[model samples]
Target: MNPPADADSPARQIDARIAALGDWRGETLARMRALVHEAGPEVIETVKWGGVPVWEHAGILCTGETYKAVVKLTFARGAALDDPTGLFNASLEGNTRRAIDIREGETPDADAFKALVRAAAALNASKRKPARR
Candidate 1:
């Protein structure tokens, strides 16, 4: 039997996932991660659902789910945010979540995506109560 895999930290696990993909999906996931950081520097990255990358500020901002054909970025509070650029396409029927599915040879508008990230962060912050001293 093969030896057990090294126990990597969540960020490193996310890095390993991107590197293991080694295709357009990897590139897309990497790009998406960068945009999340650029858009919301305060947000922290975490691994969830057996390896999915999740970005959180005051709460969950979004999740990075990579599949064979597309990389889906699902914003937790997406349905509550505005999408003037019409970035959200998939998961539209949902009331709380919205997703942007990026397939091979497609690129998301960085500015619009960043706007959504910021809006999600703001929404999360608004829901938090100030710390009592």
Candidate 2:
């Protein structure tokens, strides 16, 4: 029998989750994780809402999750930014929600993703939230 996976290892956790999923979606998610880490070595992986791995620096920047046959990359403040490359899709109408859905064998545009990440970091850094009481 194989030993249980470690929760501390993000890759392992993701792998286990992917194994459970058993689909192309899982593979796409794993690839997306690699891309995020590659884009920013300073990027920290935190388990936020629903045990999803959220990558951020100053504030909630982005979250990646597996969907049916695709990996969804969500940018929190995507609507506020200018997307001339047409890389983002409106996840919701009239809201800040935006996502890019990529499938297996489809190499995500690394440059575009990096650009979005940088933009997100800048936006998060520039914002002034209410001071904690």
Model 2 C-alpha lDDT versus the unseen true structure: 0.72
lDDT of 1 at 17: 93
TM-score of 2: 0.76
| Best candidate, TM-score | 1
Off by over 4 Å in 1: 1-7
Q: Residues 57-80, candidate 1, lDDT per residue (tens digit)?
A: 999999999998999999999999
Which residue runs of candidate 2 sit more than 4 Å off their true CA positions? 1-12, 128-133
Per-residue alpha-carbon lDDT of candidate 2 for residues 1-133, written as tens digits (9 for 90 to 100): 1223666665555567767777777777766777776767667666667667687767767787876666788888888776768878648465786888777778767787877877777787789576899
How far off is residue 105 in model 2, in Å? 3.7
Best by lDDT: 1
